[model samples]
Target: MNINKQKMIRNVLEQHSNGFYMQTQFVILHNRFFAGTHVHVMLKINNHFLVEHFKYIKLLQMILILELIVFKIAKDLIQYLKIK
Candidate 1:
């Protein structure tokens, strides 16, 4: 992947973690099955309120995080493959 693409993907993942929808989360995680990165770091100040304010949203965030991590890995892999 190009640097711009990597940046775009990272930005998307960050946003997904910050604000997530359940359906989107499912797609992300499913896509991750093809990635290598298994680590996702997200710091959200409102994360705790997610459960009280919206249970579904909280679950979606979790799913999104998983997917984002995988996506990050996949993006890196693509970049590596291109170089080779």
Candidate 2:
């Protein structure tokens, strides 16, 4: 994805995370399913928040595993990112 799209998506996630109801976390997680931008990439970015918050580690791990199974190619990349 180009920087603009990346920014747009990250903006969306950030908006949702920030409690702005303009979009939903489900939108990022679903990510147009096989269309538009890649869901794994957005989730990858979102993972940063999950990893940084120790209290949410288990949830973070769950998302990581889900991404691995669902996104296939992202498994190695996410594991390589220190999701542990």
Q: What is the C-alpha lDDT of each candidate?
A: 0.40, 0.38
Model 1: residues with Cα > 4 Å off, grouped in runs: 1-57
lDDT of 1 by residue, 1-84 (tens): 355644555565556553432223222222232243332333232122111121222334545545564555456657877999
lDDT value for model 2: 0.38
Tell me, what's the RMSD of every candidate?
A: 16.4, 12.8
Best by TM-score: 1
lDDT, residue 60, model 1: 43
Q: What digit string (tens of lDDT, one per residue) describes model 2 on residues 1-84?
A: 355644665554444342322222322343343243324323233343222221222334434544443344345556877776
Question: Which window of ten consecutive residues has the lowest lDDT sum in model 2?
Answer: 48-57
TM-score versus the correct structure, for each prediction: 0.31, 0.28
- Report how far residue 56 has shifted in candidate 2, in Å: 24
